[model samples]
Target: MSGNIASLRKEFFQLKKDLLSSILSVGISLILFPFLLGMENSLKGPIFSYIEAFIMYAIFSLPYLILIGVPVHIVSRVATKNMKTYKWVTSFFLHVIPALLIGYFLFKNTLFFLGSTVVISVIFFSVGYLLNSIGASKRQKLIIALLPFILWLLILIPTILTETTNKALMNEPNPEVEVLVNETSFKPRPSFCWNSDGSAGCFEDKEPFLLPIDPIGEEIQTNGDVTVKVLLHNTERSYTIEAYYFDEENSIQKVTGDPHSFTLPQHIQEQAVKVIATMDSSKKGSFFIPIRTGNR
Candidate 1:
C-alpha cells in the first residue's frame, strides 16, 4: 500500500509539472509571437476567414513555441525535478538564452538587456519557490508570490520616469516625416504612417504597414565611398531613398533590392542628400542628410 501511494504521488507530481509547463509554454509563446492577439480582429470576415486565421496563427507561432517556449519548459522541468542537482544551471539557461536572443535581435540597449535578466530571474525563482514551498507557512508563500512583481516595479518605474522627463525636456516632432511609435507590444516596430495626425490609417488597423522601419540617412560602408545596402524586409523598405539621390556628375540611381550608389559633389565640404517620399503621389515631405567629404 505504501509503495502504491508513493507511485501515485510521483505520477501526480509529474502531471502537475507537465500541466504547469504547458500553461507557461503557451503563455510565453503568445507573448513572444506578439501577432497572436491581432488574429481576432483580423478574422472577422467569413467562416473561411476564421479557419484561415487559425491556420496562419498555428503556422506562425510554432517557431516561437519551439525556440522560447520549449526551452523554458525544459529548464523548468529540470529545476522542478530535483531543485538541487542543477538548480542554478536550469535557471541560467532559462534566463540567459531568451534574454540574450531578445536583446540582441530586438535592441542592443544594455539597460533593456539587464531588465530582461532581472525580470525573468525573479519569475523563475518565484515560480520554483512557490511550487516547493508547500511545506512553508502562509506568510512565506505570500511573500514568494509577491516578490517578483515588486522587483519588476522597481526596475520599470525608473525607466518610465526617465523617459517622461526626457520627452518633456525636448518636446519636438519633425514637421516633415510622420512617425508612429506603436503602443501595441505585439508587433514592436516603429512605423511611418502616411498621415501625421496619428489617427486613421496610421496604426495599421487596415492592413500591415509595409515600410522600411530603420531611420534614414544612416549610410554605411566605406570612407572612400558610402554604400547603403537596403536590407529589404518584406515588412519594410525606405521608398524615400528611391526619390532624391544625385551625384556630383548628376548621375543617379534608385535604391533597389541592392545597395544603391550615389555621388556627392567633389570639392564641396558637405552637402545635404535630399530624400522625399510620396504615398499615392501625395506631397509628403523631404528629409536631408548632411554628408561630409573627407578621408577623415
Candidate 2:
C-alpha cells in the first residue's frame, strides 16, 4: 500500500509538471506569432483600430504548443501517468485539430465571432472528454471525440449569424483616406516675377508670399520666398493640393491656404510652418504661393 501511494504521488507530480509546461508553451507561442508575421493588410482598418484584428491576431499568432502545440504538450504532460499510447495519441489529436481550425480561422479572417472564451472552453472540454472516455468502447470514444467540434459549431453558428446581421445593419466604414502631402518642392519659390529695373521693385504686381518653415522641425523660418522657380515637367494634369502642419506626433495637420494667404493657429504662427498637400497618384505637380502677414 505504501509503495502504491508513492508511485501514485510521483505520477501525479509528473502529470502536473506536464500540464504546466504545455500551458506555458501554448502561451509563449501565441504571443510570438503576431510579431513574426506581417499582417498589416489583413485587418480591415489600422490594426490598432480593430478589436477583431487584435483578438484574431492573438488567436492565430501563438506558438505551436498553444494550438497544435498543445496536443503534443498534453502527451508529454501525462507521459508518466500510465496513460495508454492510444489515449495519449487521441488526446493530442482531439485538442490539436480544433486548435488548428481556430488558428486557421484567425489567419483567414473567418473568426468573426468565435472568441477566446469559446476557444478556451472547447480546449477544456476536449481534454476532459478525451481523458474520461479513454478505455471506453470505440463508439463511446468517437462520440466523446466529436463533442468539442459540435460545441464549436454550435457556438460559432450564432456568433456568425449575429456578426453577419450586425454588419448588414450597421456596416463598418471604409478606411480613412490616408492623405499624404508629396510636395514637389519643400521650399517653394514665390510666384511673383522680378522687375527688369535695378530698383529692386516687384514686377507683374503680384501679392507677396512667405516661405514656410519646415513643418517637421523648428528650423529657423526663412523670411522671404525664393524667386527661382523650377519648370513643370510632369505629364499628369491637376492634383489636389493642400497645406499641412506636422504636429509633434508626426501626423499631418491640414492648413487652409486662400489666395496667397494662409491662416494658421497661434501655435503654427509662432512655429512659422505650413504643409503643402498633394492629392493621390492622380495629381502630379501642384504648387502654392503662401504669404506672410507683412509680405502682403
Candidate 3:
C-alpha cells in the first residue's frame, strides 16, 4: 500500500513538472515568434512596441494553450514514456494537431495560415524535445525557458535610457492636442431599432462612423510636401483632428488643420503621429501612425 502511494505521489510530481514546462514553452514561443516575424518582414519599431504586440498575442493565445496544450502535453508524455518505437514522431504529430488548429482559427488568410502552422508546429516540437532532453532538473529547465525574456530586457533597458537622455538634451515636451465634444449627442448604432408599429427597423450603420487618419502608403516619405487628411464618416457630430510630428531638432511640434487636412514639415526624417478621437471630454480611441522616410 505504501509503495502504491509513493508511486502515485511520484506521478503527481512528474505531471506538475510537465505542466510547468508546457507553460514555459508557450511563453517562449509567443515571445520569440513575433521577433522572428518582424525580422522576416524587416520591420522596425521600438522595443516596447514589440512587447505590446507580444502581449496582445498572449491575450488571444493563452486560452488555447491552457485548454489544449497542457492536456495534450501531459497525456502524450505519459503515453510515450515506455514506448519503444516512433515515440518522438508520435509526440511531434500530437503537437502539430493543436498547432494547426490554433493557426487556422487565428489567421484568416489561407496561405499565411498554412505557413504559420508549419512554423508553429516545428517550434512546438523543438521546444518540447529540448525540455524532454533536460530530464527532471527544474533549475536547468527554468534558466533555458527564461533566456528569451532576459534577452528582451537587455535590449529594452538600453532603448529606454537612450530615449530618456535624448529627450532631456532636446528639452522637448511630447506634442498633444485636446478637444471636447458632447458624447450624448454622438449616435452609435442602436442595439435594435424599432418602428412605430413595434417592428424591427433596419438602420444603415454598416461602416465605422469615426476613423483615424489613413496614410497613403505603409511608409510615408518625408522629402517633399506631405499632407494627411482625416477621414470621418459621420457628419452629424463634429470631430477635431490634429497632427503632431518631431522636428529636425527632435522637439515635438503640433499642427492643427481646418477640420480635414494638415500639412506636415518637410525636413523631418520620421513622423510619429498619435490620432486621438475624444467625445464628451472622454477619450474614445487613439492610434499610432509611424511614418518612416528614405529608401530601405
Candidate 4:
C-alpha cells in the first residue's frame, strides 16, 4: 500500500507539470506571437487585417491564462509535492497582471515590444526551474541549474552590448528642417466630416478631433508630395503647426515657419508635422502627419 501511494503521488506530480507546461506554452505563444507580428509588420493583403484582429485577441486574453491561471495550477501541484507554501506564487501573479495591464494601456505599441522580451526571459527561467526541481539525479539537477545560468548569460551579454551601442548612437545630433503653417483660424463647428486625406470633404468629431492626413504608399519617392490643410473648427480651440526634417544620419533640424512657406529641406525631404490644438486653456487634440518628397 505504501509503495502504491508513492507511485501514485509521483504520477500525479508528473501529470500536473505536463499540464502546466502545455497551458503556459500555448498561452504565451498566442500572446507573444500577435505582438511579434505587429512589430514585424510582416503580413500583407486582406490577410493582414484578420491577423491584426487575432493579435488583439491574443494580447488581451493570453496573460490571464499563462501568468495567473497556469501559475496558480502549478503552484498547487508544487505545494503538494514539496510541502512548500504557494502564497508567494499566487501573489506574484496577482501583482504582475495589474502591472501588465497598466503598461499595456499606457505604452500601447511600445508595451508589446517590451513585453515580448520579458515573456521570453520568463520562459527561459521557468524551464530551468522545472528541470532543476524535477531532475532524476544530482548530476541532472546540476546540469539543469547551470544550463539556465549559461543560457541567460549568452542571451543577456549581447542584449546589453546592443543597447549600449544604440544609446551611444541615439545621443548623436542630426540636422533639422522646419515647416510652419500661417493660418490660425478656428472653426465653430465641433463635428466635421472629412476624407481620409484630411481634405475639405471629410469631417471630424469633437473631442478626439481626427485631422485628415494623406496615407503613405509603396514605392517611396523623393518628389511625390501632397499638401494637407488643417482647420481647427471650434470657437474655443486654436491650432499651431510645426514641421521638421532630419538628415541622412537621422539627426533632426527645423526647416519651416521662421522664414515662411512649408519647405522640405533637401537634407530632410522626408518630414513630419505636429498639429497642436488648444481649447479653453487646455491642450486638446494633437496629430502627426508624415511627408516624403518623391514621385512613384
Candidates' C-alpha lDDT? 0.46, 0.42, 0.53, 0.44
lDDT tens digits by residue: candidate 3, 88-139: 7787678667766777776746544444444545455556666675344777
RMSD of each: 16.0, 17.5, 20.3, 18.0
Clashes of each: 2, 14, 0, 30
Relative to the true structure, candidate 4 reaches a TM of 0.26
- Per-residue lDDT tens digits for candidate 2, residues 1-296, read 99999999977875675576556545533443332232333546646634444467666445433545556445444542456556545555555566557666654454533343334434444445555443578787776566555655665576567657555433322111221112223344323222222214432221222344434332232233322122222223222334544343445466443422343432222233333322222212233433232321
Model 4 weakest lDDT span, ten residues long: 203-212
How do the residues 111-212 of candidate 4 rate in per-residue lDDT, one tens digit apiece? 443454334434433442553354247675566445424544554565567667556434423212222222322222122122222333433222211112
Model 4: lDDT to the true structure: 0.44
- Candidate 1: how many backbone clashes? 2
Candidate 3 local Cα displacement, residue 36, angstroms: 4.0
lDDT of 1 at 9: 100
Question: TM-scores, in order shown?
Answer: 0.37, 0.27, 0.41, 0.26
> Which candidate, 2 or 3, has the higher lDDT?
3
Please give the range of 10 consecutive residues that has the lowest summed lDDT in model 3: 181-190
